[model samples]
Target: MLPRFLERLRQQADNLAGLLGNRVALFGIELQEESERLLGHLALLLGAAICTLFCLLSAVVAGLVLAARYGVLLEVCATLAVLFLLLALGLAWYLRRRLADAPEPFEATRQEFERDRLALNGARETAQ
Candidate 1:
């Protein structure tokens, strides 16, 4: 009877391990897909922003030249626009770096919880 019970327990342990393994694989796939989507979005937005910035900068330079020729005062505006855009880009880069440093969601925590629970149960069984 004890041998049969031990065999059944081993089977259950194997099943539990299989379930956790599947969960981990699924979570990894989900994480990979999310990361890819976020990176793709960032890439596209960065590309569009860079293109728009180049166009705006060209326009500003042209305007500055035209203003100088016509004796107007838009050099200050052009300078301010460039400065503000650079400041915004710097802030965005800083934010992206900070977000990248954040930990993955609940993965380590889940593993720890599983370990703790298994240990507690084993202890309880031994005590009994």
Candidate 2:
């Protein structure tokens, strides 16, 4: 009986180790995926920002030149400046909202942990 108990104990330990290893691997995979996604988003945002900067500058210059021809360059500039500022503020708020609502990282891992906890608790209740 003692020998049988020892063997069962060893099997349980091995099973626990395997479960831990799998969880670790899952976590690593999720972390890597998250990092890759972040880097890709950053790269795209940077490119978009650069393109938008040049586009806005060119457009403003063109608009200003046209307004100068009509003797309303200063007024056009002031209006555009205010419009851009308001747009920037609105976008900033939207970005903050998006970030605040972003899903938790490692969501799968967290779910897995919860499932494991529940299963372990069930097992304990049954054993009792």
Predicted structure 1: lDDT: 0.74
In order, candidate lDDTs are: 0.74, 0.84
Q: For candidate 1, write residues 8-111 as lDDT tens digits.
A: 88997897797778767767776886688679767866886798679777877777777778877576575767876886797589758856875665565467
> Which clashing pairs does model 2 show?
none
Q: Across residues 24-120, which tens digit of lDDT does each residue of candidate 2 receive? A: 9999999998898678657766876688678779979999999999999889999989977876787577667766776678999999989988998
Angstrom error at residue 97, model 2? 6.6
Model 2 vs truth, CA RMSD: 2.4
- Each model's TM-score, in the order given? 0.59, 0.81
The lDDT leader among the candidates is: 2
After TM-score superposition, the amount by which residue 46's alpha carbon in candidate 1 deviates from its true location, in angstroms, is: 2.0
- For all predictions, the C-alpha RMSD in Å is 4.8, 2.4
Q: List the residue pairs that clash in candidate 1.
A: none
